[model samples]
Target: MQNLGKADKTTDEIFEDHLLNFNTQQVNATRLHKDINNYLRCIRAMQTANKNLMDTLSEIYEKEWVGQDMLYVQAQNNEMLWADLAHKLADQVVTPLNTYQAQFPEMRKKIDKRGRKLIDFDAERHTVQQMQNNPNRNEAKFIRAKEQMENAKRTYEVLNSELHDELPALYDSRILFLVTNMQTLFAAEEVFHSETSKVYSELEAVVDKLAKEVQKGTLPRRAYNRPLPIANHSAPVIQNSSSMNSPPKGATTDNLPPGVLYKVKAAYKYQAEDVDELNFEVGEIIQVVEYEDPEEQQEEGWLMGVKESTGQKGLFPANFSRPI
Candidate 1:
């Protein structure tokens, strides 16, 4: 097959190499287009998930809560960042790759035509060689064969020359295209993350402030006709004992949580080490409540309750308190 070209002009090995590279670049560009589209889809999906989460948060957030307006603003900012990043990736990166891929079909047709022309050139060259070798060759026939060979060579050279010039340059342009488009995508990501991070930090601060306000007397957590005795005025403490391990008589059950079986007085001071456990003083009254899950009831002498002094609810060891 290679000798087919040698009948007149030999095939350019360097052109083959460039064509190979060009083909590889074409495949890679196609793959990159698919990957970029998938990435955009994932970003959109995550944005939707975030919107659902923010809406759920908004529903839970009371109007009287601290940073209620700020929460809405932060959620909007997060959504904007997601949208901006998706648009930039689609427009700046994916669109250019699509344009580059468009040329492959035309280039392939040209390449196939060049191969056909090369074979035709070789056939005409053989005809002229045979005519020259014949001792009784007709002058008109020999002249026609020469003319046909020259025309075939010119047609083949036009296509071969065009490919030789363009293929190398097209393959070399791959690096520049990749670098420029990837940089644009990365820059968009950086900006989106930076702004989104700021909004996330602000949302965190809002929750922290609400917790602090609730711990203080600023928020009306519980209002009653009578107030409980304060053990310490300078701390976030819930309960502490003043005397014996006995609760005050006639403690209000209305302020206690729902599903209260009975009130129990703490026989010993219990300090909670985990966030899911309530702390109480020796004389504090604890209102025993139902377990959130059925499995919790199976635990050895474990009970869920609310400490009457500060209204803290969590799991407490039933062995530490007795029914009053």
Candidate 2:
């Protein structure tokens, strides 16, 4: 009876309480596998898009441009780094999730088999109850029913015990998988970003060289997408009326005095009124230097500036210059 597909069909209520964890795990695992596949697909798609963009750049970059050869090399390196990162994600994350999902189908089959055994166990119990209440009970029939019920009980209990132990452990295994996958994914991205950071820095240096060449007349000037880099700047210096009387000696553009804050472009020409004042033609860049007596106040709208070309430090109307 157990080997054959035969069990008594009766109106009986079968209560199964151990299936909650298994059901929840199945749902979560299925969704997780789907999401991992989608994530890998998106990564590959992004890599493809980036490769296409790099190829376009390599085609249009002319030999006349400074650092043209290096641009091609770094572009290739960028694509290679993207490919390497995608490969690692597929191997480290997607592969493990796929392996994890593989366990579910086999376990599902066993669960279905357990349900069938439970039906048999319940049917045998019902038959034995019927035999016990019969007014003209048959001894042999009662004995057979009792034996069948005992066999069904033992079989169902064995399977139920196994599943009871396995479900909680399987659920807990997800924690280890989660930790391992996240660590691997993050570690791969860290390496990819670290390597690409160096590539990006080198690319910036190449562009800086190109920009310098264009400005110095070594290469033809072309309109660029980015602005030229500027030197670091701090706040303009404050000086007392007494310190503004003379130039800082031996200061030049080549050897700027210490505490030079920033460069300012002279927008208009102003002639000197006194020995302490500055004279400049339009478009001269002046270095705004800090004074030793930063605590004292000078008259507002009159700032002391140093001419980089001549190292002449004197008072210039603050309104006449603009920060570069």
Candidate 3:
């Protein structure tokens, strides 16, 4: 009798320990699931913010800048890449995690049902144990209690065995799942940055070229069509006597106004800087004026001339105006 009692106590203690282990496993699984869900939400929020920033950049980019078309295309490509990354992450990582988490509710229900069954089994076990100590116990009632306890034990053991095997395996799989997700995310980002950086570099080069053109005062004619600002007193003006409309003293008839020593045609476009100079189109005639200082005639590369179209006088490159 003493041995039988000792055996029954040992069995009950073993079941109590199993129940405690099951509760601990359930708590750990719930905590792990919550952490993973939080991580996924954070990733999603970051992706959304990044997408908005890219869209804002595209919206505010100026149309007149060089590479405007290319900039738009690159921005679109980056947006697509970001979208693809989010989709891939959801498909490969988040979906699986959600599926795994979905199993938890069913498992919890089974655990709860198993708890009720364990209580019934313990009550039946206690009844059979007490009947064993009774001097005039009903044999049929004791047999029925023992049978009920056995059935409850089998049902609980089945659920406990399945959970004990499955939960640890599921927990272990989180490591591989995390590694795969991180590797995929980082690899995609690496490729995305590499391609986007090239596009940025090309766009920067185009911008730099435009800036250089602006500094050199070489923009297209249409870009400079606005009227020039009148000079303020603070600005210094350059004066050249040779550029004046009145002819210098020399008695020759050719020295007179509207009279020319020779005629020449402009071979190319010329941009005039000062009021003294003439802005001439290609193929326009120019009237050459003889230099008043004979010493100035020694300079072979330039000529003093009046444009036939505007009668404005200036020193022009002799090579730019071909002799008519």
Candidate 4:
């Protein structure tokens, strides 16, 4: 009887020890599972961060490529417009030169008539000088010669006035018209060249940017308009350590929550007092927020306390409200 009691007591003690050890092991296992889950959550967060970075990079690259392509197209259109201006300027120069050449002969005839009148005046002056120097000159002949000289002098003065005044005015007017036309045509030509040069410069910069992007691996190694496939699109998720280490099969994008999408655009240098190479512009959308500021009424004392805590002078009642 004593031996049986001792054996029964020994068995009970062994069973209690076994139960304690099992419970200890269960607690250890739960702790280990919690640690593994925490580790997995950290890993998933890191992986998600990496994926987000990659997507952002891809989007930036695409925007740059598309914007550069559009610039190239616009440059081409400007080139066409410049060519048209060149043609129009050429026409303008040619038509005016043709008109002036056609009118040249009539202008020459008027100049010749004035030249003959000047010659007659010189001859009449010589006759007057000869009569004045002679002592035995006939009075009637001298008087008639004097009258003829006066008439010739008067004719010469009239011709001189017409040539110096009216004729020159007409000639000057024609010359000014030609000069103004030429100046206008030249200005148009200059504008054409200048516009073309500006377009070429702008296009060259865009092309250079595209080239560097390609070389630096920001853009794909293909033509600008060509389609390319994205690589490595796997998502990250927290996992339980009790399961196998391998990822589940047949995972799709539907498992992820919806995210905002944006198109990529060109990168360029921004100028203030200094130049900054910014990949995005002011009007570009960067992020979306869930809520916006709202105003509300509150007791003056409560507002003062809230302001003191937040270090602000103004406080809105809505700030303390919970989001639904």
TM-scores of all predicted structures? 0.64, 0.60, 0.54, 0.32
- Cα error, candidate 3, residue 29 (Å): 6.8
lDDT string for model 2 (1-324, tens) is: 434646444322222344676678779989988887888899889889988987897788777787789888988999999999999999889999889888888877877877788888888897898789897999998999999999998998787778777766777898899899889989998998999899889878888997898788788544322211222234333222445434323223345547665567776677777786789988998887655444322354466579988999976765566666
Tell me the alpha-carbon RMSD of every candidate: 12.2, 15.7, 14.2, 48.5
Ranking by lDDT: 1, 2, 3, 4
- Which run of 10 residues does model 3 get worst, by summed lDDT? 231-240
**For residues 1-324, what per-residue lDDT tens digits would candidate 1 score against the true structure?**
446444455568988898899889889988988888899889889989988999899888987788999999998888888888888988887888788878778888988999999889988988888789999999998999999999999999999999998888888888998999899989999999899999999999999999999889486332211222323233222222222123324333555445775688787777776788888888898887766655445444466788888988997766676666
lDDT of each: 0.77, 0.74, 0.64, 0.43
Backbone clash count for every predicted candidate, in the order shown = 0, 0, 0, 3
If both were scored by TM-score, which would come out higher, candidate 3 or candidate 4? Answer: 3
- Candidate 2: count the clashes: 0
TM-score (C-alpha) between model 4 and the true structure? 0.32
- Candidate 4 per-residue lDDT over residues 171-256, each given as its tens digit: 44555765766586668767766876776676577768878877887774332221112212232221212222222233232332
Q: On residues 184-224, what C-alpha lDDT tens digit does candidate 3 reach at each position?
A: 76786677678768867866776787688778876433322
lDDT top scorer: 1
Cα lDDT, model 4, residue 188: 73
